[model samples]
Target: MSEGLSTRILDHIVHLSPPGTLEDSADAFRKLGFTVTPGGTHADGQTANALIIFADGTYLELLHFTHAPPASTAHPWAHKPPGWIDYAFLGNAGTPSVADTINRRAAADGSGVRYAPEVRGGRTRADDGRVLEWLITAPAPSEGNGTRASARGRLPFFCGDVTPREWRVPLEPRSNAEHASKARGVAYVKLLVLPSELDAYAKELTSVLGVSPAASSASQVVWELERQPSDSQPYQAPTLVLNAAEEYEEEIYVRERGAGIYELGVAVEDAGKAGVAYTPYGRVVWQAIGSR
Candidate 1:
């Protein structure tokens, strides 16, 4: 795994839509005031995406498959519905990959959070026709009597760039990082869990990230993931909030999406801009960061 707390840093969260709705999804985000950058097709050619890049080097990937009944049944997104399907952690390009380190830790603690071998994945940028590649280390299916399967949607996978990181996530032109909504970067991602599953999920997350909760209560757990400070922008540590479903809407969301991300929090400049905004598939909450 990565050194120290680097393993816990948030990379990006994925927002998926129904098939053939890539442009519609981008349009929807644009209407919500985010600057949507057109992304290219995946190596498999079955998926395409658009990105909302933040100055903090994190982003929201809006993706959809080219075919409704994706040509391959084994496709990860084939059966997933449109919403906050998954999230990823920034992987390290060093000895002992994220998968190996996490698997070793899990084996030692019996947390059973095994990760599959890193797989090469990339996409051709629709904007400039450049191919960007990365190594993905995702959760492995449960083994024998292991409960590794329980960590699927709840835990994050890893993404290590093979190509230059800037090539995959461009932040030049200044305007690319400027959102009309005044949203700066990800503030936190909230995951709603069934009350009974809260503890189990929290433990799995701890195992995967090699970090303990920053704060915790009987009903909720929080991890404040630190990001590399930007030279021109103020530093903001993104968070992961895991709470038991309590509200009527939250209950329904957990029922439908299971124990996965359902809400996104964005950091904005003005308090007046702080509020909730609904996208076609997910909910975003605007939070004022006060001064700077």
Candidate 2:
């Protein structure tokens, strides 16, 4: 398997809310100066979402379940709380499938990172009745202590579009991208992990993302995702920061909820002008470019 298959793009980050709370979450983000677009219910009729699109083809997905499916259905959103949940990476459209390649490579490298078989997924646009489709690969379920572990909020999933990307992301009406707070795009995602699990999770991330952790200290590690250069753009890539929970005095999500996405760093035109509101779900950190 060729390296770097998983680093093609950072597709989207997911934030889950309580059942029937999609609009509330969107309202909160709107107050934060984001343009939130209404998304439709999934084909399964179990969940729905709203989107916050960025210029770099990345987005923030605010997801909430409409109703609980039957007990026989095996979806993961049945009992999850509101917070920054899972995230996805864009997969390549070429050659051997990204999911298969990652699984094979993990086996070869002894990384123990395994993905479930690819599955078809789709949603109907509530605004236009248009249907959008895609293929998704998620982590395989594991069992421990006589209980099945959930990959919902903890693991990264892979998505490859079956429909045209443009159809899913419309370009007309450029005003939708504009924000009152001057926010641009995601700067980084902060994940909290226990110190004992840092080395193992770091190895798994290196195998899955095809990027080694760039800077590491006793309390944190950072990985830089791949980004294409544009003539009008400066040099920078969205990052993933894994912080150790034990080193901090304040409580982290991993301490209250579990080891998963703790916060998000959003890039804005000016950090001083940006204001952050703590929604019921997760924390959003607004920072200027090149600021620590």
**Judged by TM-score, which candidate is best?**
1
Give me the overall lDDT of model 1. 0.83
Q: Please tell me which predicted candidate would have the highest lDDT against the true structure.
A: 1
Q: How well is each residue in 87-135 modelled by candidate 1, as lDDT tens digits?
A: 9888855446788888887888778678888888999999889999899
Across 1-292, the per-residue lDDT of candidate 2 in tens digits comes to 4754554366789988887888998998898788987678889888999888776567788898896556677777665567788888775443457767777767877777777777888899778889999888787877879987876566688777788765565534555556787766778888888888887777667667766688998778888876522112352668888877875532445676667788888887775865455667788888787685
lDDT of each: 0.83, 0.74
TM-score of 2: 0.90
Per-model clash counts, in order, read 0, 0
In candidate 1, position 216 carries an lDDT of 100
On the 0 to 100 scale, the lDDT of residue 97 in model 2 is: 72
